[model samples]
Target: MFKQKYGTTALVAGASEGMGAAYAHALASRGMNLVLIARRKEELEATAADIATRYGVKVLPVVCDLAAPDATQQIIHVIGDTAIDFLVYNAALSFIGPYLSTGPSTHLDIAAVNVQTPLALLHYFGGKMVARRRGGIVMMASLAGFQGSGFLATYGASKAFDRVLAEGLWYEWKPFGVDVIACCAGATATPNYNNTHPRKGSFLEPKAQLPAQVVEECLQKIGTVPSFVSGTGNKLVSFLLSHVLPRKKTVKIMGDSMHKIYGSKWESN
Candidate 1:
């Protein structure tokens, strides 16, 4: 029952599935009207229907790819004339290959959605939240974003960008009564894993609370914590790497792992 102190309106991007859909439902359960965004119209519709039926809360589904060229403007258009109490930027993408193996354009595109889009989201609605003087904005980042991962070079880097920006915003917006948090999630059972290496220790089987639990916890915590790392293992790793490992060593280890996973793909690129 620990929702944001702000009024009851929550907007979640990437709500077609996984963490996004879960966040939508969590807010709905707390009596917040919902605005869900994602590229798949049918999937968004299905998610909206379930939340409406299960929680008896209003749900609005907008189909737009955050990675699209005009994603920010499109998202802004959808929020017109509506006040949002909470904003969860939960969209994500991953390209698995070494730095050279991946095309530069593809890597930059990852930045467009993962890094630029989040900043743009902040640029658009952030002021409204600050002016109203209430609300929360959560950025969905991964522990991998904490450091460079060789095969997932662009993805890891983008996450790095997200984490840094989230923390910076928390400080900048705190005076305005707006809270920002970056959730550093560990590996979860999401469809993004299909492109990954099977034997890599990176995979964490879905269990217990699942992605839904993480989403729910995030909503419940809002202003209580400015930054958080989900999952014990992931948090443990984050702590250890910061205290025990050197950056050079960590990057090398991750790079070697990427090489192992990508094989000749890294060399070809």
Candidate 2:
């Protein structure tokens, strides 16, 4: 198995819920123990208990707010001497509004979690993986990364950085037996998604997929490829946006969609 080539422990950041928890479940099912990290201590504990019960694998829940300044060090401290064979950078922050109108602090917080944390974690764990000559890294990116969207400018940009970083790491790490992949998924049916976009059906947009399905696709594609967009509908849309349409038009269309979703809050402070 792909996972067997790596060690027995996997660290999944943001594993209290959504796609993060899904990855935790998938990893446990593969007979790997888990170290789950997130800010929500209660949710993290609950998820840890459930996964441990179901899979009979050790599950440790580390509650560290990724937005906190010392998050990377806190996570490493919580991990202690556990050998993390797989690292999944899944925690993220989504701030939807006009970029200029948003506070600088908000942007910094988003950058800390979405961009800085991943790079720091990779630098710490990736070194170990290379030294051991076996490991994997899965970074959660998004379709928004492909284009510049009005309301989602910062989030999109952060994810784009993630995608490119993972692609580059895949090249550099492949020779060292470390698998790296950027799993870019679109409109997943996470609790956050259901809460945000309640009325689902849309002629222009594909239905949001289940978290399990998206995470499964990510795990399956990890060792085989550098990057993959999860859904079929997402793939087509991404292809058209990048290849067929003008970049300006793509951005405008995405902005219009976000406006529809966020309504009065689209560009308003």
Candidate 3:
């Protein structure tokens, strides 16, 4: 049923490893050919080869930096006429510190990766889907997007943009037979998240989810809702942060969590 609806081929950005790789494997398990994009050549090709061997589906690995201005064009060139029935934008760039700590260049790169590329891809592939009258899109948003996160301010803002964009597109494209969803994921045990080396025994540490679990929930809920928080705990937390608490309190709570995890001077990409 999953494959029949959004099968044949899928394109996943930032698919070299972690949650992106999980998304690739899940789609391939459903018998979909894959076009995997990421910046790491060795990792991307290795992931593609492994998926092809394990699932017996065509896997094309394209090593392209999502922050590059011509990233969407590069992907389109590699994909040629392959109609991507499902598109997943999972690539992101984050600087985990005070916003002003990073220079303008770093913030610009984050905007490029987290915002520009996804919007460009959506416009290109989504237009094709609308014409064909069938397809799906998954934009990887974050729980941080629900409000102003202290340390991860820029990244959270970009994700908020994605969440709202996906919801609006969901409504606009529903009648055209295209499904758009923003997977508002919580803290998952991805390589990047682990690299941050978050301190033990924090309020949210124990609640951290695995990559496979997050991707599984995302796939299951894509066509069902315009946007959804991946984990049950995340869902509850999202509600409390967005609906139950006052804005200042919610922001303070998130800020304190970040302080606990990364302290004042740490950074991670």
Candidate 4:
């Protein structure tokens, strides 16, 4: 059965809504006090209030743009001396389009939010966890991380970095009683997913999971494994990609699926 294996205080980045919020709910239900971080103060406060009231656990909401240059510093300052037993690095930004056509600023923003912020948190908080000999880290990754995605080049690469980093950290920290996990999710029901791929049965659409399902699965596996794909369908698909398909075939299939979803929007050059 599931258990609360980490410390009392848990911090969740991108906790304003979607999967991040779901993670907060799961943790709070497991009796962990929350430190919620997100760009939207109102949304963050609302989520914090609801969770605090429902689970009877204290919730602190910190507003910060994770892509900002000093976001990690600001977050650390707000956290003060509280020991974060579990850290969920869930914030991410992706400018979905052909890589070359996207502006450099947007690309940098993606890198900052998806890569730099997580790295900073893991380095700082993870070090503390290692010293104390107990804690857990969950990095939100995606199926795109496993292969070269055509339209989502930057996003895919960034997720790949997250997945690899989480795995390496997991290996390193486990011996010291720290648990690190990469939650590689497939298409889930989110505002971003709905807006981007409006049609059904397109690539990841067929097996779309709920945010709650992903969070529950992630929580169950966090302390036990280095990584987990959120949904059953996603796990099966990941296994096939890993064991059955060659890299060329896998990349082609993923690229073709992406083209079907995004090709209509691109202007002919």
Q: What is the C-alpha RMSD of each candidate to the true structure, in Å?
A: 2.8, 1.7, 1.9, 1.9
lDDT of 1: 0.79
**Candidate 3 lDDT score at position 248:** 97
lDDT of 2 by residue, 1-269 (tens): 85568789999999999999999999999999999999988999999999999999999999999998789899888778888999999999988877877799999999999999888899989989999999999999999899988788999999999999999999999999999999999898888877775343235667788999999888878889999998899888889888999989988888877777775644354
Ten-residue region with minimum lDDT total, candidate 4: 197-206
* Higher-ranked by lDDT: 1 or 3: 3
Relative to the true structure, candidate 2 reaches a TM of 0.96
lDDT, model 4, position 170: 93
**Per-residue alpha-carbon lDDT of candidate 3 for residues 154-229, written as tens digits (9 for 90 to 100):** 9999999999999999999999889999999988899998887877524543378999998988888887899998
Model 4 over residues 28-140: C-alpha lDDT tens digits? 99889999999999989999999999999999999999999899899989889988989999898987667888789998999999999888888999999999999989999
**Residue pairs in collision within model 2:** none
Q: List the residue pairs that clash in candidate 4.
A: none
Candidate 2: 10-residue stretch with minimal lDDT? 197-206
Q: Worst lDDT window (10 residues) for model 3?
A: 198-207
Return the TM-score for candidate 4, rounded to 2 decimals: 0.94
* Best-to-worst ranking by TM-score: 3, 2, 4, 1
In order, candidate lDDTs are 0.79, 0.89, 0.91, 0.88
Kindly indicate the candidate among 2 and 3 with the higher lDDT.
3
lDDT of 1 by residue, 142-165 (tens): 777877776777888788888888
Clashes of each: 0, 0, 0, 0
Runs off by more than 4 Å, candidate 4: 1-4, 201-205
Point out where model 3 deviates above 4 Å: 200-206, 264-269
Candidate 4 achieves a global lDDT of 0.88
